[model samples]
Each structure stands twice: as structure tokens, then as C-alpha cells.
Target: MPIFTVAIPFYNDQNYLSKAITSCLHQEFQESFEILLINDGSSDASLKIAKNFRNCFPEKIRLINLKENKGVGFVRQRAVEAAKGDYIVWADADDVQCPQRLKTIRRFFKENPDVDICLHDCYFIDKEGRPIDKQLKWPKSFEENPLYFEIKRNYFFIGFSAQRAGLNIPFRSRCRDFPEDYDFILRALFKNKKLKLIPEKLSHYRIHGKNRSNRHSYTYRATKEILEGLNLSELSKMLQNSSCLKEKEISLAICELLMTKENFKEALEKLKNGNHNCFYSNFMQGVCYFFLGNNKDSALYFDRAYSLDSTEPSVQNNLGVLKYKMGEVESAVELLKNALQNKPDYLDAQRNLKVASNGRNSLSITKKPLRLSWVY
Candidate 1:
């Protein structure tokens, strides 16, 4: 088998699929690898573009065209099933991989036979392909656990946003959901698999209108679907024992997951003992109170949170909404303005501020922008 299987999950992406394929064809490793293209019912010219790769490199490319538009998740699942390389990697259609990507990952796997999955630091570029966004500087590497059992972030074996995580063949299952991407990586880690890291920035994560990160609601729904399928009790216990996370953070993570489902009551309960100062906890508590029409308590927690931290656009976001509802439009505008000033990339702040300001020239708030919580 080739040392790597580079899989691309694509839909109506004729404009970029060719660039992705050409990048794959020019890997720096100059070693054996295969490109498995999963075409998820593209109504555009994507199919023809992908097929052309076969004509150019018959031994290196294969295409799978589905009958209908199922979704990106399903497309990836199919590609994973078709992949034959000892190492399986996913590349989103619009993103371009550096020529050395395969060589870097391949070297890691070769040096560490125990490593099952590998990923490199990544950079984010704009829609115009400008390197004006995210820069990959992996601060930690995974070595604490047997690597196979550690579901980690920061440290090497950082949780693959699936930006790049490759598993050895004989894989257990395909990722059929959004949240499943996170859980799937965890499972792959523990299936007697280890993960290695390539610190160099070898991938460019293209951020554009159709990027899944932009569709928070759709991604969250997929996450809900996948999370609901897992054995929470079993998974929770498994997480507790793994090297992937420490106790407090994992519990907070579980609570965060529950909050996404809008199980606010359960979320609040789970967070009662959570040590971390989670803005989500305060936000969920506010949500629970808001739904109950306990505006006073809701306001109280939101105020406390706003006072505690304001860096996270989410907190400032909630605080702004609360202020607006409380007949403090001016205050809401100020809060959101503060949020925007802190992080220009925050959509919630920009959206809420524009709506609240109604074309106002300025928002006046004296408080310094607060530090944001790390999680939503």
C-alpha cells in the first residue's frame, strides 16, 4: 500500500477542486501515495475536473461520484471507506496543501511505528489566498499518554479539527457527523493508535463563505446528532481514564457539550462542581433563567459574567443582548463595540453592534475591553 491516502471530500467546488488536486499531485515526498476523490453529487463542473486527474495520473487517482447531494459528512465517510493507504488524511476541497505535507507526515509515521495518526501545524489564509489569518504555532506535543489513548489539544496529537489527522488503515468507522469528527479522532487515537506531529506549517486552511466554521448552526446540529449517538456514560468514563484531558477540563467539556443541546438544566447541573470559570456556564445559567422568565437572576449572572470577563465575543455578545432586552440599547451598543475592538474577527459583535447602533457614529463605553473566556 502507498504510505499515505490523501482524501478530498468535495461537493460543488469546481473552482477549487483542480487546485487541490494539482497540489496533491505535487507532494514533496515524491513517494507513493493515492488520491481518493469523493464527489458528493456536484451539479457543477467538479466531476469533470476530478476525472481529469485520473487521465493525467491513472495510477495515482481514483474518483467516487455519488448519485445525489448527501452532505460533506457523508462524502468524507465514503472517501474513508475507499482509502487504501496505511495512513488516511482528509483535505477539504477549497484548502490547498503544501507540497512537503505528505513528506513531513510520512517521515513522522516512519520514525514512530507506534504512531497511528499524524498532523502538522496549519496556517489560515483569506479567500483571496492572503496569509492574513491563522498561523500554526503548535505550543505542545503529545507524549504523556501512549498517544493512542490521549485525546489532546495544544500538545502534539492536538485534536485534529480534521484539518489534518491521518489514521493507519483498517480504520474503525467513517465520520458521519460534525461533532463526530471530534469523537472519531478520539476513537482513532485509542484504537491502539498513536499520533505524531509535524511542527512546520504545511497546510493552508482556506476561510471562505462556505467554510463549515461559518455555518455554526448546521455544524452544531451535526454535533448534536453525533453526540446523541454516543454512549455518554461510557464515553465520559473513557475520557476520565484517558490521557487526553485532565479531570476538571473534561467535565467542563462535557458540560459544554450538554449546553449545545440546549439541555440547560442538565448543563447547569453538570457545571455546579466544575472548577473552571466557564463563560458557557454563566451563559447557560442565564439561558435557563431567561427561558424561565427570571429576568432578575438572568441579568445578575450576565452582569457577573460581563464583569468577570468580556474578551470572548460570546460573553460580550450575551451581555449585549441582555442589555438590549433590558432597555439599555446604548449600553448594548457599547458592549458590542468593546467586543469588536477586542477581536475584529468576531461576527456576533459586528452584527449586534450594527443592528443596535442603527448607523450611529460612535459607541461610548469607558470600561476597558475584558479578557474573553477560551470557550463558547
Candidate 2:
């Protein structure tokens, strides 16, 4: 059996399929690796491109063709089930894996037999494959249940491994829509499996207009469904009982999950029950109140949160919104400016700043509610 199965699944990715396949063929590792090209029922030239690659490298490449456009989850499930390697390394059709990715992963897994999952850092590149200013850096270790962190922000990448791909096969059905990768990480961590982070940048994640993550509304809905389906309270209880996480961390994670479902009151209640009195707790309480239209209490908690961590951009942005609502436009503007000064790319802060600077008249033109940053 091969040491690695590089699984590449595509649907209408005609423009980039060949580049992805070529990168796999150029792996620096000497050990045998197979490339599984899954054609997810694309009507474009993507199938033809895959055929050309398979024809050229008949011994190392296997093609799986589907007749209809099954979603990413279905195709991923198929890939995992059909993988014949000791480790399944995922590679998106639009992304490029580094030449050393396979070599590094193979060495690490062989040396650390206990790790069940492994992920590496990646550079965020534009559609033209030029490295963008942004990059992803995952924590080398976890202070709490890794599931909590995964829920807050997805540090997991497509170019990672599920040892033998066996752990992910059972989660096939839930992997529908945009949350397949997310669902897999959460489920694996929920099962208390060990996940390690290789600090090296092993891949390039392409950002384009057609990227799946750019679909904000659909992504939010799918994410909400997964979060709501999880027994967060149970997960929280497990960490609390084990003393694996502080009460504050557990409460914050629970509150964030509750807030995602718009259960602000429930989140506040959960926060109240815990011994959480930190910046995050205060910030979350402010967020819950802001959503519930209790600006008075919202300001109170935000003020407390600000006092604890004055530099926190979310606190600055949220507090600024509260200031604007209370007719303190100058103070609001200054707070928003501070937020922007700290995080120049803060979209919510930028939007709020525009409205705050222009006064109430712009509100009619925008017709959108003032954006507030949530504490996760």
C-alpha cells in the first residue's frame, strides 16, 4: 500500500485541475503515493483535464467519475472510502500543495504514532497563486478541548490527514454543503482524538470570487445547523468535569455557540451560571444584550469589558456602536477609529465608522443594521 493518498475532488474546476494534479506528480518524497482524482459530475472541461493526467501517469493516478453533481461531502466520503493509503491527504482542486508536504507529513506520522490527525499552516494566495498578506497560524498546542477552538475559527485545512481516512468515513452523511471539513474536525475532536499542528506552511489556499467560503449566507446557515446539532452543553460539561478548561473558557464557548443560534438570553444565562468574569465573558454579555436591544446593559458590560482589555478590537467596535446608539457620535467615532487603528481590516468596524462619520442620514441609504463584532 502507498504511504499517502492525495485526494483531489473537483466540480467545474477546469481552469485549475491540471495544476493541482501536476503538483502531486512532483512530490519530493521517494515513497510511493497515489493521486485519486474524483470528478464530481462537472459539465466543464475539468473531466477532460483529469483524463489527460491519468493517461500520462497511468500507474500513479486513479480516476473516479460520478454521473451527477454530488456535493463536496458526498465526493469526500467517496474519496475516504476508496483511499488505499495509510494516510489520506486532502488537496482541493483550487489549492497547491508544497513539494515537502507529503515528505513532512509522512515523517511526522511515522515518528509520532499516537497522533490521529495532522494539519499544517498555509499561505493565503490570490486566484493567480500570488501570496496574499494574510496567512493562517494554528496553535501548536491546545489549552482546552480542541473542538472549542475549531468552532471559533477553522484552523484545519484541506491539505491535512485523517489517519487511514477511517475516522472520517462515518461522518460522511453530515458532510454535506460547506461544512464538510468543519464537521469532520469538530466530530474528530469531539471524540477526544489527538490533532497535531505542523507549524510549517505546507500549502497555498487560493482565495477567489468562486471560493465556497465566500458564500456567506449559505455558509452561515450550514454552520448554524452543525452548531445547533452539537450537544454543546455536554461538551462543556465534559471539559468542566475533567478540569481540562477553565470555567471562563467553557462558558465563553457555550455562549458563542448559543449566540450563533441567536439564543442570546440562553447564552447570557449560561454565562451567569459560570464563574466567568474575564474580558471575554464581559464582552459576550455585552454582545448578548446588544442583540436583545438592551443597550443600557449592553453598554454596561461593554464598558466593563473595555476596562479589562482596552485594546481588544471587538470590545472597541461593539462599545463604539453602543456609543453611537446613545447619541454619543464623537465618542463612537473615536472608539471605532481606535478599533480600526488596532485592526485595519476589521470590516464591521469600517462599516460602523462610515455610518458614524456620516451621521444618521447614511443609515437610510445603507438600510443595514450596524455591524457588531461578537466575542467567541
Candidate 3:
């Protein structure tokens, strides 16, 4: 049996599936590894491409073609079930892997036997395979508890990481969106947190018009579904063991979900139940009150959020806009200027500052720009 099984699942993406499979087939690792390509009922030429690679390397490559259009999670689960290796790696059809990726992961696992999962870095590429974003590095805290960071940002791409086999084959979660990857990793880490990281950029994550993660509303609903599925007891335990300020973060997540649903009262109630000192919780509360048309209470919560984290440019811009709405032009201009100092390219702050300086009616503070949290 191969030492690693690289699981590649493809849907209708015939254009990039060949590139993904070729990368796996050309791995320079001295040790053996198998490529398992699962075709999820693609209406396009995806299956034909998989079979073409399988024909060339019959021993090293295998194919599993599903009859119906099952989702990505289900396809991945099928791939894992059919894998014969001791370790499993992930590969999206649209992403490319570095040639030494398998070799590097093999060496790391051999050197660090205690770690059950390994994650490496990857850079974002455009549709034409040109680098568009810098290499994404996992924060130090994420290195400590990868699951927590996964909740915040799903940076651990299937193309850059591998996990030991014989754990949960089909990772279960309520999330069915593109970030179902996050839910899968969370389940993998729940029982074993012994995750290690390699400091190399080992994959290229392709970003295109079809990237599902760009759909903010859909992604947020999926994430909230997964978080809500976690019982409070388990979630609280996770917070206690993993982080000091995690409760506040958890509360903020819940509040954001409520706010998205326009449950302003419930969002405020949830935020009040945890660390009120958190900049996120306070800011979310301000948002909820602002939406509910309680401008007085909204101003109070915005001030609280500013006091907690005055350095956050988004908060400063938000409060500045609110102050402008309240007829405090001088204070609004000063706050907007401070925000610009913190982040010079903040277009909203610059625009608001310009309006305040010109003594023109400010844009309806109610029409706030998209939340900064969603952009990342």
C-alpha cells in the first residue's frame, strides 16, 4: 500500500482537473503514494479526464465515478473510504500542488510522530494561474489550536495538508457550503489537537469567478449552521481549553448570525451573555441597535466598542459615520481622520471625512458599507 493517498474530488471542472491530477502523479517523494480521483457525476468532461490519467498510470492512480450529483463532502468521504494508504491528503480539482509537497509532508510526519494532522501554507492564484495574493501564513495561535482558527478562516486547503488515516472517514457537520472544508478539519481536530505545520508554501489556491466563498450571504449561513450545531456545553469546553478570550469570540459569532437574520433583540441578548468587554461583541451590539433604530443605545455600544479597541479602523469609521448622523461634525471629522491615519487606504473613512469637511449631508449612516469581517 502507498504511504499517502491523495484524494481529489471533481465535479464539472474539466478544465483544471487534469492539472490537479498531473501534480499528484508527478510527486517527487521517494516513498509510495496513490492518487484517488472521485468524479462527482460531472456533466462535463471531468470523468473522461480522470480516466485518461488512470489509463497512463494504472498502478499509481485510481478512479471512482459516482452515478449521481452528490456534494463535495460526500464525494470526499467516498474517496477516504476507498483509500488504502496510512495517510490521506486533500486536493481540489482547481488547485495545484508543489512537486516536493509529498516529500516534505512525509519527512515532517516521520520527524514528528506525535502530530496527527499537518498543514502547510499556500498562495492564491488567478484563473490564468498567475499569483494574485501573497502566501497565506497560519497565525501562531492557529498553530496552537487549528480548529479555532478554522472557524475564523478556512486557510487549511486540501492541497496543502494531510492527515493520518483510520479516523472519521466522512467528517460530519451541518455546513454544506464551500467552506465545508472548515467543518471537516474541525471534526478531525476535535478528538486530537496534535496538529503540526510546515513553513513552506506547498500549494496554489486558484481564485476565479466561480469561487463559492465569494458569496457572502450563502457562506455566512453555512458557517452559522455549523456553529449552531455545536452544543453550548461542548463549545464552551472547547473555548476553555483552547483560548482565554474565546468566549467573547464565540459570543460575537453568535451575535453576527443573529444580526444577519435581523434578530436584533436576540443578538443583543446573546452578546450581553458573554464578555461585554470584547470589541466584536460591543460592535455587533451597536450594529444590532443601529438596525433596530435605537440610535441612543447604538451610540453607547459604539463608544464601548471604540474604548475596547480604538486601533481598529473599521470601528473608528463606523463610529465616525454614526457621530456624523448625530450632528457632531467636528467629532466625526476627527474620528474619520484618526481612522484614515490607522488605515490610509480606507475608502469609506476618506469619503466620510470628505463629506464632513465639505459640510454636506453625510450618506445615510444606516447604509453602512459591507462589514469588514465579511471581506476576509
> Highest lDDT among the candidates is held by which one?
2
Q: How does each model score on TM-score?
A: 0.73, 0.83, 0.77
Candidate 3 matches the true fold with a TM-score of: 0.77
Candidate 1: tens digits of C-alpha lDDT, residues 1-376: 7767788878888878888888888888877889988888889999999888888888999889896877665666676667777767677788888888887777766677665556667777777778864454432424444332222221322222222234443222244234435545555554545555656777777777776555655654554554555445665775677766678766765665565456667766776667456555566566666655676777777777666665655667667767776788878777787777778877657777776767443322211123232222
lDDT of each: 0.63, 0.78, 0.76
Question: Candidate 2 lDDT, tens digit per residue, 1-376?
Answer: 8988899999999888888888888889999899999999999999999999999999999999998988888898888888998888889998888899899998888888888888777777888888788755444345335676677766565555545556643544453466687777787777777787677888887888997876766876787877777887677776676546666776677778888878889988988888588877787788888778798998998899889989877788888888888888889889989988988976778888887777752321111122332211
Off by over 4 Å in 1: 126-130, 137-183, 186-196, 242-247, 273-284, 310-312, 323-337, 340-376
lDDT, candidate 3, 1-376, per-residue tens: 8999999988899889888898887888988899998988899989988899999999999999998877777877787789999999988899999899899888899999888888887778898899884546456576766666665556656666788887763654343354667677766666665777888878888988887767765776676666555544564566567654556666665555456556788878877776577667777878888888887888898899789888788778888878888898788888889988988977778887888888887543422223344113
Best by TM-score: 2
Q: What does the lDDT come to for candidate 2?
A: 0.78
Q: Please say which candidate is ahead in TM-score: 2 or 3.
A: 2
Q: Candidate 2, which segments miss by more than 4 Å at Cα? A: 123-125, 131-135, 168-177, 241-244, 273-275, 333-345, 350-376
